[model samples]
Target chain A: MIRSAAGLPARAVEPVANLWFTWRYVENNLGDITTALSQHVTLTVQAVVLALVVALPLAVLAHRRPRLAGPVLGASGVLYTVPALALFAMIYPLLWDPRTTVLIGLVMYALLVLVRNVLVGLQGVDRGVVDAARGTGIGPTRLLLTVELPLAIPSIFAGLRLATVSTVALVTIGIIVGYGGLGQLLYRGFNSQYRAEIATATVLTLLVALVADLLLMALGRALTPWARGGR
Target chain B: MRDDDVLGAAIRWLNDPLVWQGPGGVLARTVEHLGMAGAAVLLAAAVALPLGVWLGHQGRGGAWLIPLTNTSLALPTLALLMIFASSGLGFGNRPTIIALAVFAAPPILANAWTAVREVDRSVREAARGMGMSSARSLARVELPLALPLVAAGLRTAAVQVVASVSLAAFVGGGGLGRFLVDGFGTRRYGQVLAAAVLIALLCVLVEAVLALGQRLLTPVPLRTGRGAVARS
Candidate 1:
């Protein structure tokens, strides 16, 4: 449309304008593309990190106090039931900041996924291992530090991977607020009926999610060198 | 400090009769939302169910389920909706439903596959011992045993679909999300909040109903076995 407005296409306008995948669009909008991508990555990472921060202590508490697990998870479940779009809109009244609204919503949404997984990971450490550690004159803190935390790393990584990817997808809803990252570009494409922009942004979002998940999996392996190919 | 806080104003907006009775009333918008979500889930079920059931029966597709789920979870529904709308499918209900269906498929497929597979192996052998055909055993025994989990999957899909149907409004398709988009555009945050509350309640209602359905779908004997220890 900008090119058409620039009189770049006069005769073959329809074909050129309607093309869904052109290198020209990518080249012309490289800055915008990179900004959206970086913003998307930033929002996703921030949300997951915040969620992990909140989830870890709660998950530990829940793991330690079994009774708390039900309530913690139940609360997160209720929060999760609130849809992403609605959550963003709901947060706007109080915060009045678009990025914060998206951030808060992403954190709230990822909380359940992270908390549940982390709790499972911590609880999943074999009781025999803990008992054995205790029997070998290891202190409570030592048992947890040496055995439980290491064992739980895989599940925590799984949670982190899921939260990051889902948060990446949810960050697009930030478009409603004014900071939806690549979501903004996708929305712009939708509004202007620009297939190239839509397809490009969509593929980029998926790629980002894919890369994040893969990196987490690799990190999980690096951390848990003891875990070869099982679980 | 004031009755004009978001919650108070949202309540006031919800109390307005005008918001409840028009061509664009809450009732109509809600029905439209359900219609779109229902269609998407059903469409997804149609495709995913049989494939999951077959895969589970054969017990070979477990390798791909996690990857499939991770990929599906990463697919942005809004992007998919936009792509479908822009790629000659045009905007509105068709594109929205198709896009939402893409979101609904993974949970249903994973659940269906796991549900059927989780049926006890010895139970299957007993069915075969009774001379029941493979198909007959699956239909009568395995499927019934799997009903609870299958329904759980449907419940997840239903809630997800209903929650996401609000995206329809972004594409000019009619749904409760219209209120959110319009309200946001007009800076009517109260109405937006009210509509969101309504949608969240709808999700909870759907979840509860399907949860009940799952329990009902479970065979009476199996339900008893799992929980009610009748060991006298």
Candidate 2:
């Protein structure tokens, strides 16, 4: 009676079967999974690097001319308000390319933080220090490079770290438009109701994000030794 | 369809009286979207604000935890939604709320922590000198000063949540997302365009209201004279 009330046998339990099945899937499709993982990472890197290239100069300009700061930050803040999927829909028709849509969306999403941080970093330099540098005959360019930029490294890196991790997360939504990455794995897994597949893909995607974040943190530490123990 | 055709259709959809009523109507969808997003933000604030303030007041635990919270943004909402969906938790509201609430927590938590932590030491000392207890000092002095940032944090979280509720459509949920998801599914470009416009407008409205709140919360001194220029 108790056995009957328990219903299905232990072998029929969902979780164990799902685990075993996932193990088999991983064993059989290791190469494809790796490719997906790499694709996701590549997409994240491309977007973040592109955003940095554009945002850094813009940030410096804003920092130099305080009048521009409000407008620049406002524009990026407006861009940030647009939802990822909505942006994907708007861009897909115009660009007609999944990768381009995803890349552009990621870059736009990244701008607010990257620009804000760079500006903040630059402005954070002491006015006294700037005056001192001027007093010592440092040129405008030299002063920026020697004092301001170095001091800004930690904040700039903080922004980079944020942009990278968020880009990793947002890349998943691009699966709808055929920018296959670990997100594709997730989509397929959910569609097939394969517990193993869904679990593995989610974990793998999160791991990729975690690894990327840790790497950036380490890179920041290595680059900004002066900012180290001060924190 | 051409751009003009899409715009025309969307305008028609917007004007249609039929679209304004019923369970699947625009009004219903907006309410639903607000319900889910509002609940998520409220829940997140409930947990994040008090804890963040406490830690900020104590000046402990936040050094590491805040950064960790920030990193939680890396966790995909869709992945979280799916995991919860598959756990027999059913689809739509619950999973979406859970995912959004998690996404919403970080900004509020981080900002609140910063606001509380940065409250002037002299202010706290003054409160103590007035014979206030630690809790009293924190409640009266630290928290009031932290209000502007805390409000700003709430604004950020609310806007993000509003935008993200559209993801609920992906998992058989209700919201303005239905227009996007259902339209895309049916190749109804007009609906998709219309939905996207509505979401953007909604974000703008939320931001404007909250910006006013933040401005009002700013201390009187910070709004005028030298303090204003310093902040700017």
Candidate 3:
């Protein structure tokens, strides 16, 4: 029996087992586990969408005015250099909301990859293609939408793939600030010295990452079939 | 602490080698971080370079490997660190080193593979026609051509590992990250600022050194073209 600090009877620690026991434990608490998984996905999806909305226009603006691109990209790189925990702590005082910390960190991560990729993708469009579009007397808006964007989609998707992977990895850090996810399970397992729980969480996180990676690869292939063989 | 006091203390510490003392002392700490970084680079080179060479030579496996490497490159080091550390792994410098080595591998591998594969096929064929063995041709013809791009990739990986290793301080595997963590805990803003400054300076210095190395290593005059310009 494990004794309480106040001098009660001692209590026995739980026995360890193999993978099957771990699986059974997890299965018993599947509801909590699924909720945690969904929370992780929700956080990642929300952050990526929010980041694209902000970064896309910024990329276009920077492209139109080439001089601005350096400063914009530089600023984002600086933000990228700031450690995730520091970023959360830095904003904590201003926002005073723990719930948004992961969101904010994810957005910051997205900016570095997404903005640069978008700019590169846009700039990388064949000059001949753009010139021909202009020669055809297409409006600037029409050319940008039809020709420039379609060509740039490959680069944009590359950035999205990167951003998605990063977001999933970072969402794990949200566990520190009391947000729920696999990180929560990992953290709990660490504190409790529960090897089973730790392994379960870790494997689950890797699976999430692998699944996200495969999905993005498929999407990338679909969108940029031409680039498949070229690269 | 007042800004003036903090600045004065920092200036004093800069002149004080005592603050840097440890096993190898200040010099040791410096060497240790360098050694750790160097080991990681060496390990990454060993794993990534060969894999890259094979992928570059074969060119079939890249469909899976390229994206996999890219995804790995973007993985969050801190989260990974925590996961590994918490597994009763008995964390310290070794685990941190391993984690960082893994962190640094993908960029070097990806770049090396791409660079090797990208070498003009004609160059390889010509070398082979001269009765060079496949191995000899790879070493003399392909690797020489691939060196510049692979160097660039290594440079990027170096910077990344340096930054990521600083997080190891959180696991009680001391480095300059010790100063950053200590500063945060004790509210010593000056220490935090100094550590940040040192890290930034180190990154810049490493980049410059790698750039210089690239210049020295490449056999061909650096090309001034869109590809070179884009990479820079």
DockQ, per model, reads 0.72, 0.54, 0.21
lDDT of 1 by residue, B82-191 (tens): 88888778779999999989888888888888888988999999999999999999999899888777777787888889888888888889898999999888888888
True contacts kept of each: 0.75, 0.56, 0.11
The residue pairs that clash in candidate 1, if any, are A175-A180
Best by DockQ: 1
CAPRI grade, predicted model 3: incorrect
Q: Write the per-residue lDDT of candidate 3 for residues B1-232, one digit (tens) a residue.
A: 3344555555665667776676734456556667777887888888988888888977577766666676674455754665567645667677787888888888888888889888898988999999999889888889989888898788778877766666666666755566665665675655555555666566566766776787677765755432251232
Report how far off residue A192 is in candidate 3 (Å): 4.0
User: Per-residue lDDT for A123-142 in model 2, tens only?
Assistant: 98889988998999989899
Candidate 1 residue-wise lDDT, A111-217, digit = tens: 88889888889989999988888889988677777888899998889888888889999999888777899999999998988889998999999999989988988
Residues A1-231 of candidate 3 have per-residue lDDT tens digits of 567998977666566453313667687768877887888888888888899999989999999999999889877755665556445444433444567877887788887889999999999999999999999999988988888878998888878877887778777666535673777776666556566676677667777877876787788778776677864
Overlapping backbone residue pairs in candidate 1 total: 1
Task: State the number of backbone clashes in model 2.
Answer: 0
> What do the candidate models score in CA lDDT, each in turn?
0.85, 0.82, 0.72
Error of 3 at B148 (Å): 0.9
Count clashing residue pairs in model 3: 6
Sorted by DockQ (best first), the order is: 1, 2, 3
**How does model 3 fare in lDDT?**
0.72
All-Cα superposition RMSD per candidate: 4.3, 5.0, 5.2
- Across all candidates, the chain A TM-score values are 0.92, 0.89, 0.87
